[model samples]
Every structure is written in C-alpha cells, then in structure tokens.
Target: MMHKFLMSVYKEMLLLKRDFGGLVILFIMPLVLIITITLIQDSTFKSIHETKIPVLLVDNDNGQISETVKQNLNESGSFEIVTQIDGKTINEEVAREAVFKGKFQLAIVIPEKLSKDLQLKVNQNVEKILGSFGMEDTASVAQKNIKILPKEVKLYFDPATQLTFKNAVKSAIDKMISKIETQSIYATFQDQLGENDAPLFDQKSFISFKEIVPKVNDKEIMPNSVQHNVPAWALFAIFFVVVPLSINIVKEKSQGTLIRLITNPVPYAVVILGKTATYLIICMIQFFLMVAVGVYLFPYFGLPTLDVNGKLILMSIVALFSGLAAIGFGILLGTIAKTQEQSAPFGATSVVILAAIGGVWVPVFAMPKVMQYVSHVSPMNWGLNAFYDVLLRNGGIGEILPEIILLLLFFLLTTAIAIVYDKKKREV
Candidate 1:
C-alpha cells in the first residue's frame, strides 16, 4: 500500500517536473508575486513606520477636551497633523477627498458637543455612584438635570486604505481620546470639589495596559510583510494545485488510466488516497519553500526576518487543513470537469476570485462591509486567518481552533461531494 502511494506521488512529481508551465505557475509564479508585492508593501509600511503619517484633523468642537486631544495628538509624533489645507481649515468633504485621493492617510472629526458629552458622562457616573449608596432621589435629580447624549469621535479614511496605515492613525487617536477622557473625569471632580483639593477619581486606576508577546523575545517577532504574504501566496499556490490535478484527472480518465485502475487489484479508496497523498505532499513542499524564501531570501530584499514564535505546531495544523481543503477541492473539480479546457478555466477563475475576496490580495477590513461578509465564505479566508492566528497574533492551537474546524468542514464537504458524484457515475 505504502509502495503504491509512493509510486503515485513519484509519478505526479515527475509529470509536474516535466510540465514547465505548470511548475512556473504553481511555484515560481506565486514566489515572484510574494517577492514583488512584499517588496512594494514593505517600502510603504517602512515609510509609514519611519515617518509620521499625515492626518487631517478637523477640530469642530474647539472646546477644552478637543483642544487637549489635539495637543496630545500633536505631541504623540505619530502624525504630521494637518489643520489646514491650501491656507484654509479642513472642510469635511475636502478632507474626505484628500484621504480618498491618498493626499492624507486619515481624517479625524471632533464633534462640536465633545466637551458637553464628556461632562454628561461624568455627571451620570456620579449619579450612578450616589444611587448605589442609597441616595436614589438625589441621583435621579442629578441625572435628570444633566441630559447627556452619547457621542463618538468620527474617523474618516478611504475604504481602500492599507491596514497598517489605518491602524496607526487609530492607535494614535485612541491614545489622544483616552488622555482627554482622563482629564474630563478629573475636571468633573474639580468642579464638584474645590480645585485646591485633590480629585478622588484615579483615572489611571480606571485604565490599564497589558502587553502580549510571543514565546520568543521581542526582537525575533515576524515582520508584517512576511506575516501577510507567506500564508497568502502559499495558500493561493496550494489551491492552484486544483488546476493541474483536475487536468491530470481528466486526462487520466480520457486515456484509460482511471479505467485501468478500477480493473486492478488495488481498491478504489487507495487510488483516491494515493492521489490525495500526492497532492498533499506537493502542497507541503510549496508552503515550506515559500517559508524558506520568506525566512532567508526576504532579508536580502530588505524584508523582515520571520523568527517563528515556536508555533510550528500551530502552523503545521493550519498547513494540514489548508492542504486538505485544496486537495478536496481539486478532487471535486476533477470529478465534475469533463475536459482540460473546462477544468483549466474553471479552476483558475475560481482560485483568483476566492483570493480576491478572501483578503489574500487585500485585507478584509479594507473591503466594503458587504464584501467583508462575503469573504467569510471563501476557504482561503479561513486558511489565512489560521495563519494569522499563529504568525501575527502569536496564538496557541486553541486560538485557531475555530478556523481549523471550519477548514476541516470545507474539506469534508468538497470531498463528500466528489465521492457522491463518483458513486452516482459508477451506478449509472
């Protein structure tokens, strides 16, 4: 059984080696894509990292908290704050256009009622605290006297903007808002109590920070370029396996190899398993080779080192599901496709479409809300998320369990469909 499986794998490998175009498409093409895109994105991320992103700040409030938040943002050095465009203060439509046109990375709008909202929140918190201490009527009066509506600082950015750029701006904004909020709480106490007396509320006590690091030291962390493209192009290449596998299956059936197999002493399941084993091995090779390029060759091109966070076990599980899902899809496509002409276009088109919607070409967050929801249906999205859990998130097996289960289900569904169709074909 083992010998037969080995033979099947050897045969596929030989065919793959001989098919120069297939070899290039499945392996070389994705590698080139990874290198090219990573290099391009690396420069952009590096620029953003090295220099502050340009952000348009539309401070409509002109109040205490808004001014403090603006001051904090300016002092943070994460942004080159643009208060004016072409000798005029930022206009909402113009700022949005600037962001859309790539003139600014982000636009932040501080609403006119920010100070009032913060004061209201403080008053409500005081009322709730007093109510807890059996002063219900006094608390009710305080709450009724101060009508505080909810408010949020509106952040504007282009839907097509890169994830890192958007995240940096958000992080900076969050910090600024936090500082203003802390001050607001302090100011509320100052108003209630005399300014000379210390405020009872400890803002630091209300907020805390925690850092999550991989098992490895901080210096060994993987770069964003490696973090993204490795799994992305690797999964893409693995799925592209469907094209050649489908073509081979169609060719084999046409040439009587499949017919000859059924007549042989070998069981049908072994033949199917052999083909699956062959493609699984091919997928593993493609993944490892890409990892090798990302780890070793990428540094030469100014990409970050992928000092793996000792999550090879987690990554291996992801790779297993990824390979299974690809092979299962290939088998299903093979079972349904009658000819190379049919399989080739269908397989290639499906992979490309899946990749586009799956956050392989672009981050899912950058996509429109509808597209983001639609992306969940793609197996590539699940695979990419599993990879992210291990690679970027420094997650354990438990963290990626959901994605693993989903990918497994995808594999089972596609393989079941293929098996059902095959059984029907045989019965007919």
Candidate 2:
C-alpha cells in the first residue's frame, strides 16, 4: 500500500515537473500580490498617524483667539496651518476658494472682533451673576443692559471630505473654543474678586485614556499591514491551488491516467491520499515564502516587519490544516468536473467568491450584520481567523483548536463526497 501511494505521489511530481513554468508562476504570483498590497496599505496607515495634512487658515481677527488656535493646532502635530499662498496672505474668500478647489482639505476663518466680542460676552455674564447675588456696584448694574451679538467662526471643507472627518474637525474646534471661553470667564472673575485670591479650580484634566496592546514576553506586538497581508494573501494563494489541482485531475482523466490507476489493485483512497500529500506540501511552501518576505523584505521598503516570534509552530499548524481543507475542496471540484474548461474557471471563481465573503478583502467586523453572519460559512474565513489568532492575539494551541478542527472536518467531508461521487459514476 505504501509503495503504491509513493508511486502515485512520484507520478504527480513528474507531471508537475513537466510543467515547470506553471509551478514557478504558482510561487511568484502570490509573493508579488502580497508585496504590492502591503506597500499600498502601509502608506495609508502611516498617513493617518504620521503625515500632516495642510490646511488653510484665514485669520481675519488676528486676535488672541486666532493665535491660540494656530498654536494649539501646531502642537497637535496633525495639521500644517497655511496662512499664505504664493507669497500672498490668504483671506476668507481666498481660503474658501482653495478649499473648494480641493487644494486644501479644510479651511478655518476666524471672524473679525472674535476676541473682543467673546470678552464682552463673558463680562456681561459675570455682571449678571453679580446682580443676581445683589453684589454688583450701582454703576455696573446700568451697563448690564447693553446686548452683544454672538460671533461666528466659519469652517469650509473640501467637497471630497468624508462626513466623519467633518464631524471630527467640528468637535475639536468646538472643544477648543469652549476651553478658551471658560478660561476667559475665570480671568474676569479673578479681576472682579481680587488678583491675590487663589485659583477657583484646577484646569488640568482628571481623566485620560491609554491604549493597551497585546504583549508577548513583555514586549508589545502590534498588528501591521505586513502581518495582515502575509497570512491573508498566502491563504488566498493556498486555496488558489484548487484551480491547478482540479485541472490536473481533469487532464489525467482525459488522458486515461486515472482510469489506468483505478483498474490497478491499489485502493482509490491511497491515490487520493497521495495527491493530498503532494499538494499540501506545495501550500505550506507558499505560506512560508510569504512569511519570509514579510519578515526579511518588508523592512527594506519602510514597512513594518512581520514578527512570528514564538508562534511559528502554531502558525504552521494552522497553515497545515488550512492546506488540507483547500486540498479536499480541490479533490471534490476535480472529481465532479468533466473537463478542464469546467474545472478551471469554476475553481478560480469559487475561490474568489469565498475570499470576498471571507474577511480577506475587508474585515468581518466592518461588514453589515447579515454579511457578517454569511461570512461564517466560508472556509477562507475560518482559516483567516485562525491565522489572526496566532499572529495578532497571541493564541496558543488551545485557542486555535476550534478552527483547526473545523478545517480538518471540512477536509474529511469534502474528500468523502468526492469518493462517493467517483464510486457512483463508476457504477453507472
């Protein structure tokens, strides 16, 4: 039995060697895909945290408020405030035009008399408080009847800006103005009471937030583009083996190779096992090559390095089960398909559909609730979640076992169906 299985494996190896160019393409294409995707996404990630967006600032007031806004924005390190363009200072009209033309994503127009009007408003409110307490001077009570109109600060956004970005900018500006108003009120009260008096309250924040990332051996291991793309595209490439594997089976049937093997004394299950072992090895090689690129090559391109650290064994285990699932699916496809035309396109399209719904192109959490539930049926989703568990979540064998078992069962079920289908066809 062992000898017959080895011979079957050797025959498949010979067939693969005969088509050397196809074998090379299988390895190279996925590496190219992984590198290209990682490069594109890494820049997007950096732009959010490291790149500064240029914004037009029209300081019509040029008062304390405008100066404070510019200073605060600069300190945040997120915006580059442009007060001038082409050697000319920008006004509200020019800022609006630039933003509308999409030259800048955002523009801020600080209205004239903002500082003076804000101070006047604070003064009136303080006097009103004093009058309600019966503590205002007789002369000050007469001045409280003067009404001050509210000042407006205008924000112009590019038409292409997302609504979330608009809301975030608005919230930030509102918070800044609220803080400035509170401080001005406090200062006015100090002058009214006595300059030598202690502060009314501390201005420092009492609450704060800090992000806690997953750690391994006391070192933080944050997920990055490379970590995500390597496993995802690798699994994609692994499942893509179905196309060639199915086509090869169809070719063997057409050429009478499979018929000859079935007529021999060797069991059909051994032949299937032989094919499975050969293709599983190919899938593992594809996975490790992708990991090697992430670990060794990504850093040279200024992308974050993929860190396997102590999880190599667990990752390999997941890859092995994933490969088996893909192999079983290939066997079923090849067994049912009548010709290469039927197997090739169907195999490729099914893999693509599975990948799309499997949280490969987008995260499952980002999908609509209905789609999220639908994604659970895809084998690729199972493999991807298992990979993420080992790479990002610091999961051990116990944590990954459920997914591993699912993949193994998927392999068995598909292989059984293929065997039954082949048997029924032979009897017919």
Best by lDDT: 2
Which stretches of model 1 miss by more than 4 angstroms?
A: 1-6, 47-223
**What TM-score against the true fold does each predicted structure earn?**
0.64, 0.89
Instruction: Give the 10-residue window scoring lowest on summed lDDT in candidate 2.
Output: 42-51
Model 1 per-residue lDDT tens digits across residues 154-241: 8888778877767877887787777777777676656554455665665566657876556555454434777888889889988989
Candidate 1 residue pairs in clash (backbone atoms < 3 Å): none
Relative to the true structure, candidate 2 reaches a TM of 0.89
Model 1, C-alpha of 87: deviation from truth (Å): 20
- Residue 232 in model 2: lDDT: 92
Report the lDDT of model 1 for residue 413.
90
Whole-model lDDT for model 2 versus the true structure?
0.90
Q: Once superposed on the true structure, which residue ranges of model 2 sit more than 4 Å away at CA? A: 44-49, 136-154, 159-168, 192-196
